[model samples]
Structures are given as structure tokens and as C-alpha cells.
Target: MPSLPLRAALVLMLVWPFLAQAQPALKVALFEVAPYAQKEGGALHGLYIDLVRGLGAGAGFKTEIALMPFARVPLALERSEADLTISFSTEALEGAAQALGPVALVDSVLITSLARSTRELPQLKGALVGRARGGCQDLAQRAELALRWTDISNFDSALRMLALGRLDGLCLTRDVLHHYSALASIERSRLGAEILVGQRPALLYVRRGLAPEVIAKLRVALARRSPVKAD
Candidate 1:
């Protein structure tokens, strides 16, 4: 028979495997992002939602979804309301969110009112353009567009301004404009969605101190996906 200390050590060693095997659920935060992550009848659907679930499978984690406003995802992670976020701009990652890498999940676009002949970023040179505040920095930077700019509060405001002819053009993501414009009676022909050449970099933010194996499994899965490309 071993001493009490040795017996305690052996008991801990025996229980650790069972404790580790009983993995905690991974809480993933998301918002209403159409064609990418949309919640209907309490279920998530789209490429990103699928991707996260797939990665979770690889990591042996059961994912629990938490739906919130787009702006609150990071805050959810901060408060431990979630263990991860669906996807967000890597540049915006701060606090407890640690970026894994860029996800080439969607295309960026330049939206123009029907009347304007702004076919692309270059054509909008010298025209007044509105960008969603803190959105599409990569597009602007990559395009090297030289235009008068304003920071609008959200895409809805920018879309309204465009309809009223307050702004000549706006930069936004494809599905975002696609989903929201239809809500406002804006036709696709009325709004030109020129898919930008460069890809928008999306990142998966995990809560700090999450099991490294989880992140590693995600990295492996991401690597196995289609390579990022211009649309």
C-alpha cells in the first residue's frame, strides 16, 4: 500500500482522464448574417455556421449557438457568454478574443445607386462615397480608391442615403447588401454589387485560455478548406 500522498496522487491521475473526456460545450456567438449565418426557427444555416460546426466535430466539441446582434458578439466573448464568435474582422479583435486567422468566407462589394454609372471602385473616383463605420477597411485599402468618404452608422442608413441620392456609392459585403436591399425595395439592378478583387479577411475569435487543441483542430480544418480567392 502507498502513503496517503502517493494514494492521493494516484487517485487524481485516475480521475483526470474521465474529467478531461467529459468536454464542456463550446458556446458560439453569432448574429443575423444572411447567406452566411442566419437564424430561422431557432436554427443556424449557411457556410460559416456549417464551417464552425464542422470544426467543432474535428475538435470533439458540441457547439451551442447564441444569437445576438452583430455588434454584441465580441462583448459576448468578453463576458463568457460564449466561448467563440462565428466570424468577425480580425482588426476588430480585442480583449479576450484571440484571432486564429483569415477566413475567405465572403466577398466584399461596392454598391451604387441605379442612376450612378459607378461600375467599380475606380469609376467612383472623386465621388462622395459612404462606408459603414468600421466596415470594409480592407476593401478601401486594397482598392486604393480616391473618393470623398463619409462614415455611416450602418448599412441601412447608407442604403437609405443611396436611395435618396445623398451618397454616390457605398462599400459593403455581398450577402449583407443582398439581404437588406430587398427589404428596402432596392433591386439588384438598381444596386450594382461589383465583387471586389481582394478577399475580405474574416477571423474566428476564441476566448483566451481556451484549450489549445481546439484552436489547433480549427486551424487544421481551415487548412483543408478551399483556398481564398477573388470572386
Candidate 2:
């Protein structure tokens, strides 16, 4: 007969594969925003996507990614439908998840038609500005600007509105503006001016009550990746 220790080891070896297979995959959620998270050809790709994939690999957890509209991101976290996400720092999001500090930063800016003479926030007091629906627009209010706000479905639509003279300006990250514009083959001279509003840090957020070990592993991965600066 086999020794007691040998028998125990044999049992463990027999069930180890099943034990490993029983582990659940981490659920990660992201919103569709070009250059950050973009879905094309039914495949997801971009900065945040790559970061999350790397973190999951380093943490040794299988990760499942879901792409949805911005409005649903916080709601998913609130309902425990998602385990992780990356978003611009905002009170609304922080209320739903624990921010793990900034992984990147984004420059919020206002862009207008090249023909429009209004180049600054104060200059367009009451002018209509387009913003992505469900996005944070506290910058204008914080700056004490009473700009008329209009919600657009996405960056592509906002860019189209700006080009068609439907919106006085568009308020979003500078990189997003440049990205969509480039994709649409719009030239720099065609856009009026970029007014720097402020910089918002993009943070890695995990839903509350997530496994502490998982969070710790991600933190270690993030630290190893080095902090990404503003785009």
C-alpha cells in the first residue's frame, strides 16, 4: 500500500485540475470611448483594454471584458454586475466603486468650429455645447459658466454635430476630439480652437466588496506598470 503522505498527494493531484477550473473569471466593464476603449470589427481594443488585460494576466485571473455605454458603467458596478473598470475620476463613480488612484490623466477641453470666434469658455456664455450623455460636465458649472449643454450619444455624433454647425462647441477630452476628427479625416484648421478646461485623472476602479486579494494583486500589477501620464 502507498504511504499516507503519498496517498494524500495522489488525491490532490487528481482533483487539482478541477479545482483550478472551478475558479471564476473576473468581470471587467468598460465604456466605448476611442483611444481609451473602442470596439471595432466586434473586437475590443484600446488603452484601458490593454491595461486591464495586463492586470488580469499579472494577477493570474481570467478576465471577461464587457463594453457598454458610459451611463451603464456605474450602474453595473452598483449592482455588482461588474468587478472592475477604468474611468475619469468623478464623485458619482467613486460612490459606486473604490478608486485605486490614477492610472492615467485626460485633458478636458472645449472645441469649436474654426469659423466660430468664441475661443474660450467665458466667451461662449449661453452658447450650446455638446457633451457625451452620462458624462461628467462639472467643469463648466465649476467654472461658473452658464453654457447651454446638449447631450450627444457619442463622440462620433458630437464631432458630426460640430462639423454641421449644430453645436456651438463640443466638450470632451482633447485626445478623443483629435481621434474622432482624424478618423473622419477632418483637418486641424477645420476646428476652431481647443480651450483647456482642466485635467481629470483616469482611475482604476474596483467594485466594493471585491476580493481583497484580487485588489492587492491588481495594485501590484499597476505599480509595476508605472503610472501613465495625461494624454
Candidate 3:
């Protein structure tokens, strides 16, 4: 017969799978935005994707990433369906989730078709403007602009619409504009001057009332890393 210690070890080995299954990984929500987060060939890779992975390692927890629409991230966190996400620091967002820390200072811009001959916001009065669904609310609310804002399902389609004169303009981040424009082969000359909307802080957010220890570990890890910037 096997020794007592050997038999006990065999018993533990048989139950290790169940023990591992009982411990859930931290859930993260990410959206498709090139250079920040993207899904390619069934793999997630981007600046934020790498940053989150590093932070998870430093904080001593495994993570599971879910790709969803940007607008839905906050609700996921609010419902405890996800543990973390990256978003712009907005008054509305603050009311929804606890911000972990600033991840980057991103430039926002308003771009229109050069053919439209409109360089400034007020000039776009009564014109149709395209925006990512639930994005760029701050820019759209500028008192000087009196344009009709429309929700776009994707950047690719929006850029195509702008190139074809279907949209009068689009409000989005500078990096996002550059990325999708290139991917769609839209020339810079096709778009008018980018009106600067000022820099906004991109922040990491967690569900409200998350464990204090976890928040501390994540903040410490985040502080040790460099912030992402436009390429």
C-alpha cells in the first residue's frame, strides 16, 4: 500500500482542478480602438491591452478581457460584470465608477471634409456631423457649434461617409482619426484642419466599492508604469 503522505498527495492532485476553477480571474472590458485596444486574428493587442496585462501581473491577479462597444463598458462595470476599463474622465463617468488613475492625456479634435469649406464649429450650423455612438459629448456641446449630431456605428463607415461627403464632420480623438483614415485610405488633404478640442485625461476605472487592498495594489502598479501617448 502507498504511504499516508503519498495517498494524501494523490487526493489533493485529483481535486486541484476544482480548486483552480473556484478562483475567478479579474474581468476587464476593452473596445476596438486602434493602438489603444484592438482584436486581430482572435487575439487582443494594443497599448492599453499590454498595459492592463502588466498591471494585472504586478497586482498578482489573472485577468480575462471582454471586447464590447465603448458605450457599454460603464454599464458592465456598474453591474459588476466587469472589474476594469479605460475611459475618458467625464462628470457622468465619475458618477458611474471609481477612477483608478489617469492613463493618458489624449488630444480631441473636430474634423470636416475640406470640400465643405468649414474650418470652425459655428460654420457648421445645421450641418450633419458623425460621432461614435456615445462619444465626444463634450465637443458636441460646444456653444459655438449648432450642427446636427448623428451616431455612427463604426469608425470605418464614418470615415467613408466623410470622404464621400455624406457627413459634414466628425468629432473624435486625434489618434483615432489618423488610424481609421489610414486604414480606409483617406488622404489628409481630404479633411479640413483639425480643430483642437483640448487634451482630456484617459483614466482607468473600477467598480465602486472594490476592495481597498486591490485598489492600492493596482494604483501602485500603475504608478510604476509609463502612460501611453499618441503615436
Could you tell me every candidate's TM-score relative to the true structure? 0.72, 0.88, 0.83
Q: Give the lDDT of residue 227 in candidate 2.
A: 55
The candidate that wins on TM-score is 2
Higher-TM-score candidate among 1 and 2? 2
RMSD of each: 4.7, 2.2, 4.1
Pairing residues by index, what is the TM-score of model 3?
Answer: 0.83
Provide the clashing-pair count of each candidate structure.
Answer: 0, 1, 0
In candidate 1, what are the lDDT values of residues 1-231, reduced to their tens digit? 899999999999999999877878899987655666778887778667876787677667788876666667777777778888756463444665887776555677777766665456666767677765445666556445666778765567678878777888877777777777876767556554454644566676788777788778777876776634323
lDDT of candidate 3 over 97-154, digit per residue (tens): 8987877778888888767656566777777888866677677666566778898878
Total clashes for model 2: 1
Clashing pairs in 1: none
Where model 3 places Cα greater than 4 Å from the true spot, the runs are 1-23, 90-92
Q: What's the candidate order when arranged by decreasing TM-score?
A: 2, 3, 1
Candidate 2: list runs displaced more than 4 Å: 115-119, 136-138, 141-143
Pick the winner on lDDT between candidates 2 and 3: 2
What does the lDDT come to for candidate 2?
0.82
